[model samples]
Target: MNQLKGVVSHHEREIAELRADRELAVAYLKAAMESLDDPDERAAGLLALRTVAEAHGGLGAVAAEAGISRESLYRSLSPKGNPTLKTLLAVLKTMGMRLSVEPEHQAHA
Candidate 1:
């Protein structure tokens, strides 16, 4: 019983750490998204995606998490590549993030 308890405790700790790491990755992605209007937004987003990919493991790992092929991930997140909405959502989900929208404000005269 004591050994089983220890095992459970260890697993719990590991889960907590994973959750924290995931939160950090989500924050990084958000920042990258917000930087989209900047001159280097594309590069920044790619870098952030790469970092998240590395953290989660690698391209293959991220692809697996996204339920797609490694080649697909490479193409979708590539600088000149275009990805469909489905692919984007899958990748975001793999990175523990999601898409959201907010209303844009109109300019006052």
Candidate 2:
């Protein structure tokens, strides 16, 4: 049981490090947002932002870059958070990324 916990912790640490990369972080954020129509997935996207913030430079630094209070960022990024578009754009900008739109594929009805 202890070993399993250690392994999980180790993997989490690795993921945090990976999230620090700009490319990977962008991809992760995009994937999360793309799945946001589902409530559960939306929560997961918000959670992913928290992880990315931590990876980039912890919540404090990310919040500072986004010109928002750390507390607000924390609350807005929480699992049940509903951050506004402004907040989301600011955070993405702080991370040196931007939001882009792509047409969703559809089949003829």
TM-score of each: 0.62, 0.81
Error of 1 at 67 (Å): 2.6
In the range 60-92, model 1's lDDT, one tens digit per residue, is 988887788989878777775556778778877
Compared with the true structure, all predictions reach lDDT values of: 0.68, 0.82
Candidate 1 ranges beyond 4 A from true positions: 1-20, 37-40, 104-109
Model 2: weakest 10-residue lDDT segment is 1-10
Candidate 2 per-residue lDDT over residues 52-92, each given as its tens digit: 77788788999998999999999999988988889999998
What residue pairs clash in candidate 1, if any at all? Answer: none
Count clashes in each candidate, considering only residues at least 3 apart in sequence or on different chains. Answer: 0, 0
Write down the worst ten-residue block by lDDT for model 1: 1-10
Q: C-alpha displacement of 18 in model 2, angstroms?
A: 2.5
C-alpha lDDT of candidate 2 relative to the true structure: 0.82
> Pairing residues by index, what is the TM-score of model 1?
0.62
